[model samples]
Target chain A: MTVQDVYLLSPEISLVGLALLVMAMDLFVKRKAVLFLMAVVGLALPVALSVMLWMDVQAEPGGRLVGVYGALTVDKFALFFKFLVLGSAALLLAASLDYAKRLTRLQGEFVGLILLSATGMTLLAAATELISIYVSLELTALPLIAMCAFLGSSRSGEAGLKFLILSGLSSALLLYGMTLVYGFTGSTYLTEIGEAMKNPLDPSVPFGGLVILVGVVLMVAGFGFKISSVPFQMWVPDVYQGAPTPVVAFLSVASKAAGFAVLLRVFYVAFPSLEMDWALLFAVLAAISMTFGNLVAMVQTNVKRLLGYSSIAHAGYLMVGLAAVASRIPNGGETSALGSLLFYLGAYTVTNLAAFFAIIGIANKIGGHKIDDFAGMAKRSPLLAAGLTVALVSLIGIPPTGLFIGKIFLFSAAVESDLAWLAVVGVVNSVVSAYYYLKVARLMYMAEPASDEETPASSISLRLALIVSALAVVAVGVAPRILTWATDAAASPLLP
Target chain B: MDLEKFLILSAVLFCIGIYGVLARRNAITVFMSLELMFTAVTLAAVAMSRYVASRQVLANPGDASEAVLQTLLTGQVFALFIIVVAAAEIALGLGIVIAFYRSRETVDISQANLMSR
Candidate 1:
C-alpha cells in the first residue's frame, strides 16, 4: 500500500486510533462519561477526513478513488455511508449517556467496543474486494456480538450466544458463496468477477448457471441475516429485547445500513451480468418480510421487541427499492432506485435514532420497556413523548415526514419498473403498520398515568440528541433537495 | 481429477455442517457445527486455488504478470483469511458460551428463552 492508499483510508484509520485511544484512556481517566464524551468528540476527525475525501471524489474523473490496489474504493457512495455511520455513532453515544453509565465497571470498554465497531462500519462501506469485505464484515460484527451481551444478564448472555452462532453461520454461508464465485471466475476482484460471469461457467444444472445461482442465493441468505429481512429475522427481536438499549439502537440503524451498503456494492459491482431473477427474488422476500414482521409486531408487548419487528418491516420496504431497478430510467428521466434507497436509509437512521433515544430516556427512569409502561407519557414527560410521537408518525409514513417522501420515491420507482404489484404490497403494508406504530402514540396521549409521580427529566445529552434527531426527521421531510442531490451523486458511481 | 470432485466433497461437508447446526442442542455444539461450515469453505478455497492456478499456468505458460499472479492467488489468500476470521469468531463465541454457562449452568439452546414472551 502506498501513501495514497493510506491517505484514502484516513477516516477508517483515524477511527481505529480513536477506538484504541478510548480504551487506553480508560486506564488513566477516572470519569467514564468523559470517555463517552471523548468518543463522540473523536468522531469529528473521521467526519472531517471523509468530507475531504467526498470533495476529492467529486473532483475525480469517475467520482471515485480506487485505493489499496482496488481493494478499497473511495467514492461518493462510500463517503455518504461513512458519514451516516459516523453520524449515527456520535448520536448514539451522546444519547446513551444515562444507559451506558449504568455499566459502572465496564463503561470504558463499552464506549471502546462501540468505537471499534463504528470503525468496522466505515471500512465496510469502502471495502471493494471480497477478502477485504469479509475481514471488514467480521470486524463490524464481533464487537457487536460482545456488545449484545455486554450487560452480562441471563437474557443478554442468551442474546450474545445466539448472535454469535447465527453470525458465524451466516458468515460461513457468505464465504462459501464467495468461494464458489472465486472458483468459477478465477478472481475475487468484483470487476473481474462481473466480467467472468458474463458467460457463466457450467451448463449442466440449475438452468445452466448452477454455480453462480447457488453462490448468489447463499450470499443473499447471509446478507439477509445482516439486514434482518424475514426468515432470517429470528435473531433480531431476541437480541433487541435483551441487548443494551444503546447497542440495540446501533444494531438496528448503523449495522443495517452497513449491511445494505455492502449488499448494494456487491450486487452492482460483482453481479451486473445476472438480471431480473434476483429482482424477483428480492421482491418476493420483501413481501414476506414486511407481511410477517408487521403481523408479529402487532402482538409484541415489549417496546424493544416491537420496534425490532418494525425494523424488519422497514427492511422489506427498502427491498422494494432494491428490486425496482430494471434499468437506467427507461421511462421518465427521474431519480434512480438506488438514490431512493440511500435517501430512505438516511431518513430511517435519524427517525429510528430519535425513537430509540426516547425509549432509552423513558426506560432509564421506569426500568422497563413495556408498551404499557409508556401510558400517559405525554403528561409525564412532554418532550420525550413529543419526540417519540414524531418518530412513530414518520415511521408510519405520514405526511410531513421523511419516510412519507422516501416511500413515495421508492414506490414510484417500483411502479416505473413494472413492479406495481410490489408497490401495492408496500403501501398496504405501510397502512397495516400504522396500527402498531400509532398504538404507542395513542397510549402516551390518551391513557392515564399509573402514578402521580413524574419521571425526572432526561439527561441533558439525551434531551439534546432526541430533539436534534426529531427535527432532522422534519428537515428531511420538508427540504430534501440537498439530501436528494447527495443521494443522487452517491448513486451515480454505481449506475450508468 | 477435475475441480468438480473437490467441489462436491466441499458441498457435502458444508451440508453436513448445516445438518449439525440444526440438529445439535447445545450451544457449543452448534458453534462447533459452524466451525465445520467454515472449514468446508476453507477446503473449497484451497482446492479451487490449486486447480485454477494449474489451469491458468497451462493456458499461458510464460506470460506471468503481477496482476495475473495476484488473481490466481485470490483463492488461497481467501482461504487464509477465512481461517483467521474463524479463529477469531471461535474465540469470541467460546467467551460468550462461557458467559452463558455462568448464568444458566447449561448451554442448551432450547433452555435459553427468557425473552420469548
Candidate 2:
C-alpha cells in the first residue's frame, strides 16, 4: 500500500498504538498520577486524530482507500463515527479517572480497553466487506465483556458471561448469514452484492432472494442485539446492572450509536432494493423495543436497570429513523428522511451521554445506584440534580431538550414515509418514557431524605463531566444546525 | 462426494448444534455447541466454494483460471477466519466460566443466580 493509503487509516493505527502505550506505562509506573496523566493524554490524542482525519476526508474527495483488498474502509461515514466514538471515549475517560481510583485500581487497563473498543466501533462503521465487519464487531464485544467483569466481585461477571454467550450466538448466526450471502452473490463486497441484486428478477440465480433476505434479517438481528432493540435485548438490563456506571454509559451511547451507524450504511447502500422486506421488520422491532422498554422501565427501582430499559426504549426510537431511511416517504422523497435520521442519531447520542454522566457522578457520591437512593438529591446536590433533571427531561422528550428535537425529526421522518401509526406508537412510548424519568426526578425533588447517612458527596472531575454533558445536551437541543450539518455530510455512504 | 451432500451434512450439523446450545446446561458445553455451529458454517462455505469452482472449470475447461482459484480461496480464508474467532470466543467464554465457578462453585447456569434478583 502507498503511504497515503496508510495515512487514511492513521486514526485506527494511532488508537491501537495509544492503547499499547497506556498498557506499557501501567506495567512500569507505580504512581497513580502518572497513570492518570497517561490516560488523559491517551484520551485527548484520539480527539486530535479524529479532527485531523475528518479534515483529511473533507479535503480529499474520494480519498478513502480499500486497503487489505476491499475489507477495511477509510471514508467520511467512518470518519464521522470515529469522531463521535473518540469523543465519547474522552468523556468516559475523564469521568472514569476519579471512579477508578475510588472503586477499582485497574485504571490503566480499563481506560485502554475502552479506547480499543472505540477503535473497533470506528472500524465497524467503516467496514465495506463482511469479514472485516465481523472481526471488528468482535473486537468491540470482547472488551465490553471484559469491562463488565472488571469490577472484580460484583454481578458484573455474571452479566458479562451471559452477554458473551448470547452475543457469540448472534455472531455465529450473523456469520452463517454472511456466508450464505457470499454464496449467492459470489463476492463479499457490499457494492458487488448491490450490483448482483440489481437483476433481482433473474431466475437463473440459484436461491431466490429468499435466502439473501434471511441473511439480511440475521445480520440486522445481530446489530439489534448490540443496539438493544426488542427480541434481542434480554441481555441489556443484566449487563447494565452488572457493569460499572461509566462502562454502562459507554455501552448505551457510543456502542449503540456505532451499531446504528453500521445499520444505516448496510441498508442504505448494500440493500436499498430490499427495503420492502427489512422496513417492515425494523418497524415492528422499533415499536416493540420502545414500548416494552419504556413500560418495563417504569417499575425499575435500580437506577442502572432503569437506564438500561430507557436505553432500549431509545434504541426503539432510533430504529424509527432506520425504518424511515429504509422505507419510501410519500412527498418528502427517500434520502431526505435518511438525512433526518442521521441528525437524530447524533442528537440522541449527545443527550444520552449527558444523562449517563449525571448518573455516574451521583452513583459515585451516594455509594449506591438505586433509584430510591436519589431521594432529596435536589436538596443535597443542586448542581448534579439540575444536570440530571436536564438529562431526564431530555430523555423524556420534553420540549427544549435534544431528545425532543430528535423525536420530532424521527416522527416527521416516519410520517413522511407514510408510517403514521409507527409514529403514533413512538409518541405513546415517549409518554411511557416520561413516567420513569419523572420517577427519578420526583425522588430527587419531592421525596424526603431517609437520613443524613444516605446523602453522598460528589467529586470535582465527575462534576465537570456532568456539567459538560449537560451543556452539550442543551446546546444541541437549542441549536441543532451543527449536528444537522454533520449528519447531512455523512448521509451518503463512502463507497469504494 | 459432491458439494451438495456436504452442504446437507453441514445444515444438519448446524441444527444439531442449535439444539445442543438450547438444551445443554453446562456453560462450557453450551460454548462447545456454539463452536459446532461455527464449524458447520465453515463446512457449508467450503462446499459452496467447491461447487462454484467445479462449475466454473466445467464451463471453461482447460483454463485453470486464477479467478476460480481466488473464489475457492475466499471460502478457505473465511473458514480460517471462523476458526480464529471461535478460538477467541472460547478463550473469553472459558475465562468468564472460570471466574464464575470461583464464586458460585458451579458450572451449571441455573445455580449461578447470586446476581439475579
Candidate 3:
C-alpha cells in the first residue's frame, strides 16, 4: 500500500509485466526465437531486484521486511526462493526453446504461462498470510495445468485433466482446513492464528482441540499433493510421464520447492503449537514416500516415469528434514533442520534441472521416452550423456555432487534432532535409489544403441542450460558454505 | 437455525461431494462434485463466521463491535476468494475435459488409462 511496499514487490510486479509483455509480443511477432530471447532477458530484472531485496533485508536490523498490510514478507527466506524460482524459470525457458518450437501455434502461450507460473511461485514464497498463500498457490498451479495439456496429445490431455481434478480436490481440502482454523481463531493471518492457538479465545467452541487438529491434518494432505509425498502421490508418474518434458522438469523442482516453501512458512509460522504431532506425522509420511518411490522407480521403463518416482523419493528425503524440524522444537537448540531443508531444496533444484535438461535434449533428438532409447547416448552426444550421468550420480547422493552434500546435512539434522531412525530410513532409501539411477547410467554408457543412426545433437541453448546446471551441482557439492550461509539466513526467520 | 445444524448440513454436503469425486466416472460429473465441495466449504465458512460474531458479542458487548465486524468480514472474504477460484478451476477443468473428449471420444475416467502401467 505504501511506496516502500511497492518497492518490496517490484520483483513480482516485474515478472507479471514480463508475462504480459511476452503475450502481447506474441501477437506482433512471428519468430519464436525472438520471444524466447525476450523472456530470458526479461528474467534478469527480477533476479537483480531479488538480490537488491536481499540486501535490503540484510540492511534491516531484524533481517526481515513485512509489507502490504502484513500480507507479504520480504526476508532471506523469501529472497532465497525468489532467486531459485527466477533461476529455474530462466533455465526452463532455455531448455524449452525446442519443445516450444514444436508447439508452433502455442509457443507464445507456453512461454507466457511459464512466466505467469514463476510469478506465482515467487509470490508464494513471500506470502505470510494464509489467504495470500492460498491465492498464490492457485496462481502457481492453474497455468501449470494449462501447460500440462499444451502438447495436445491424448496423454497430455490426460495429464492435464488428472492434475486439474486432483489439484481442485486438494484446494478444497486445504480451504476447508483454513476455514476451520479461521473459525476457531477469528483470524486469517498465520501469526495471529499461531498466537490465538497458543491460548484459546473461547474453549467452549465444541471440540476445539480436535477441530484444529483435523484442520491441520487436512492442510497437510493438501500440501502433500503439491510436494508429491506418499498417499497423495498417485498423480506424479502419470502427470510427469504425460506432460511436456520441460513442464515436468519445472513441476518436479520449482513447483515442489514452492510447495515446501509455503509448507514450512505455514507450519512453522501458523502451527508451531502443534509441532510435536505434525512433526511425527511428517516423519511417517517421509519414510513411506522414500520407500515407495524408490521401490516403484526401480521397475519403470519410461525415463520420465522413472524420474517421476525418483522425484517422489526425493520428496521423502526432504520430509525427513521437516520431521526433524518438528522433533527439534522442544529442545530448540540449533534449528539446522530447516536450514538443511532449504539447502537441500536448492541443491536438488540444480541437480534435477540438470537431469531433466539432459532428458529434454535426448528426447528432442531421439523422439523417445523409453530408457532403452538412451543406450549408446555417450557415443552420440558426450556432453549430454556425461551431464545426465553426473546428474543421476548426484541424485544417488554420491560424493562431489550437490545432492550428496544435501543429504548429509538433511540426515545430520535428523540425527541431531534425535530422529536417528528416520535418518536410517533415508540412508537405506538412498542406497535403494542408487540401483535404478545407476541402471540409467549403465544404459547410457555400456548398452548398445537401439538403432544404427546417431541421435541428433541438442540445441545450443539446451546444452548451455545443461552445462550451467551441472556445473552448479558440482560447485555446490564441492563448496556448500555459500549456499549453507544463505539457507541459514533464510531459515532464521522461520525458527524462533 | 442453530450453528450445529448449519455445520452438520455442511458436513453432509462435503461428504457427498467427496463420494462423488471418488465414485463418479464421468469427467463432468467429477467436476460437478468438486464444485459441490467448494459450496460446502462456503457454507461452513459463513456459518462459522456467524458463530464467531455471536461469540464476540456475547464475550464483550458494544466495546469490541468493530473487531467483531472485522473478524466476520475476514471469513466472508475467504469464502468469496474460494468461490472465485472454484469458478476458474471449473472453467479450466471443463476445457481440459473437452479437449480430452475430442481426442478420445469419451469422458469416462476408467477408460482414460493411456498412461497407466
Q: For candidate 3, lDDT tens digit of each residue in B28-113? A: 99999999999999998998888877776777777656656677577788788989988999999989999899889999998779
What lDDT is obtained when candidate 1 is compared to the true structure? 0.88
**Best model per DockQ:** 3
Clashes of each: 0, 0, 0
Order the candidates by DockQ, highest first. 3, 1, 2
True contacts kept of each: 0.79, 0.43, 0.73
* Comparing 2 and 3 on DockQ, the stronger one: 3
Using TM-score as the yardstick, the better of models 1 and 2 is 1
Over the stretch A60-93, how does candidate 2's per-residue lDDT look in tens digits? 6675645666666766677778878887777777
Over the stretch A387-481, how does candidate 3's per-residue lDDT look in tens digits? Answer: 99999999999999999999999999999887899999999999999999999999889988777775466789999999999999999999999
Which residue window of length 10 is worst by lDDT in model 3 chain A?
A: A200-209
Against the true structure, candidate 3 reaches a TM-score of 0.98
TM-score, candidate number 2: 0.94
Calculate model 2's interface RMSD in Å.
Answer: 1.9
Give every candidate's TM-score on chain A.
0.97, 0.94, 0.98
Whichever of 2 and 3 has more TM-score, that candidate is: 3
lDDT of candidate 1 over A180-222, digit per residue (tens)? 8777777888877878877746553222367777888888888
Name the runs in model 1 displaced over 4 angstroms. Answer: A200-208, A326-335
